[model samples]
Target: MPASTEQAVRVAVLADSDTRWKWGALTARRLVAAEPTGFVLRGRATPTARQLAETGVSTTPPREVTGAEFLREVRDAALRGEGYDVVVLALVGGTVRAVLQGLSELALERRPVIVTGYVGVVYEKLADGLLLRHGADVVLANSRHDAERFRAVYEGVGADASAVVEAALPFLGGAPYTPEAGRDTLVFAAQPSVPATRAERVYLLRRLIGHARQHPGREVLLKLRSKPGEHTTHLEELPYQRLVRDLAAPPNFRLVYGHMGEVLDRTDLLVTVSSTAALEALHRRVPTAVLTDLGVREVLGNHHFVGSGLLTSFERLDAGVRPEPDAEWLDRQGVAAGGDAYASAFDAARERVADLLAGPALPPVSPYYTADTAPGYLPGILARHRLDVDAPEARPGGLRRLVREAARGAYRHGVQRVAPAIRRLGEL
Candidate 1:
């Protein structure tokens, strides 16, 4: 592309320091390198920021911006006669939903083209087919199986039901190893919330403890990712901690917290209750077993990649089998599919953004000026600020209520100490 055309095609990504952001940053770098004039707008707090900055990529200051702020920034840039060729909202779940709702209200005129990558599971109400149906110009799935699943569910919900499965960031390579006898080491990656899954994780950990005792020299490592200070109490609160504590007393069992990449690399076999880490392990050609407890087989099942050395089990893993992933297995796991598919998905998103920009400008949908247009937006913001004021619940049902209360407590306890600025913003 010519310099003028390249300069006109700026791309901005809204993401943080997560796996998805790492992939998005890689893709952005590739795109900008292809078109030298292309610029990347990235959040300072994003995990990939330092990596990008090392490569001489310009970055914006870390802001406590939400999905609403993301959209507003894009719009503001356009209003100031500065428009991007594409604005990619690489957020998952509630954030994505908020962005869509905000866009719906804006009635944007000459809006910069918008695109989004659906990187998380669509099983939850906040991150399900509803958001997929209304949020993006094009919905991109991490796997073909996921794409088909999304279409089936969305079709039932009267959604457009069109989506492309693209290999998620950190593209996989062909599997190189065959199953070989190795030391007995098991690794488990923890997920964010959803107590049911956490319970399952506890159960799996207990089972692994038993296995370690039986196998003598075998080892079990539980990888934990909890906020500081909260980690000790949270672990102490688990019903299985007694088992874990006993196991920790022995030389065979260990608890490893933090340093995810290093832990994964050292593990012999990986086990997960329900986490995207299983996919990450797959990339490393590690044999992975996913526990199917909590009656969540349909949602957390690993049956789709059975032939790929990725096993789903409700029971303990058998000791004799040496699991190894092959090239054919990687292909089945969507590793054979090239990165171009992901790029194509981005292209489709670009088309949708063009359509939006070709139309008229829109007005703001959210009246409260908080992050989301949803009912609990104000309260959620206030709770984060530790304002000591009661706000309406963000989600429906008792479970959401409990989660909000917990979040509020987290905010009040220590989040306020880390950043008193949110309180100032809330006051304003």
Candidate 2:
């Protein structure tokens, strides 16, 4: 509904992952879709400030930048005055800290960054989460429960209460109804973080093998987020190949990765260690069970699916356990039975974004540690942002990181050199 003559509002959504990108895209498009008010909005479509701001009336796509580039590759971009009225942080880990610092360095009215990635199984306790929650101008919460959690934490820490905006967690709400004609594939949407260690991973695989054996004809695929040596949450990089070799390479078991929709279409039963992927399976009405054998709160966020059937013991799998989807818990997570709420959330978010665009610019909010506490985090992120003086790992793309990278490279080179020798020794 933008006016034919008025300028469009440009928002740069910085994301490197699937979920962040979706939310960023949705939010950006929604903001652009807003009807024009009397105010003349401009600079919304410009990629970088060095380039001229466009006055055209069109929905500008959110500039999707990788987290690494936003954080480590900031100076050149910021120096060029290549910034946005809003920079959405859809990243986690050191990248979040680094990007915030880079934005602060630009000193261009401290552009408002809408902090995102607030959802179930709160990573809010982590360093990156803490920094993002405190640092962002607007913190988005997927559910009222999550919003309350954010509010409680902010209140306890005496931070800005106005930043939190509870909204429906963005989802692929319009998945085509997949009919189960003859599909019987059982999929484990595996996580590198779950199963904790190498030994635990082996145990889980062994359990899967045992369960697969029970259903003689069923094919089981372990879906991994990334291949070996890829970036993930786990410490060790154990490949399914290694596990298969160790387990004599079972025929029915294999590692697979592709579109979730494709997998769900062919899947008879979907299982996981409390992955958000569970929501997808449940949406398809695919028989789903949240693996809770570990029951560790930090690792297994399975509690969020309390009403959904828990697959704690493989013995239950052997005994023929079926998924009992919890309509209430699912509704609360904005996954099931609450389709209306989810839709409404999108409308509200658009309204909110429009309001955010119109509101007078406020002082820059702290994007690190504790916002309420001044002189936050010894050798605080502010120094790194303004001075570009890094505080070790706390700062992104710095001297220590370069040194660590060199060391890691040398170590990896040594491993590659030694690997062939080790294989020969095993043969001998």
Q: Estimated TM-score per prediction?
A: 0.62, 0.73
State the displacement of the C-alpha of residue 126, model 1, in Å, after optimal TM-score superposition: 10
TM-score of candidate 1 versus the correct structure, residues matched by position: 0.62
lDDT of 1 by residue, 1-428 (tens): 11243245566766543444444544454433332122222232233223333323334423333344455565666577665555455554445455555555555555444455544444444235344334455455565556666566656655555433243443333343244466667776655343334456556666766777777767777676543223220122332333344334457776665545556666777777556566666666667766554544544544444555555453546454544555565654454344455344344334444445444552233222334444455345334322111223322244745675567556545532344355345545
Clashing pairs for model 1 are 17-47, 106-362, 106-363, 107-361, 107-362, 108-360, 108-361, 108-362, 109-360, 109-361
Best by lDDT: 2
lDDT of 2 by residue, 390-426 (tens): 3463255667756755675566444444654575468
User: What lDDT, from 0 to 1, does candidate 1 have?
Assistant: 0.48
Worst 10 residues of 2 by lDDT: 37-46
Instruction: Give me the overall lDDT of model 2.
Output: 0.56
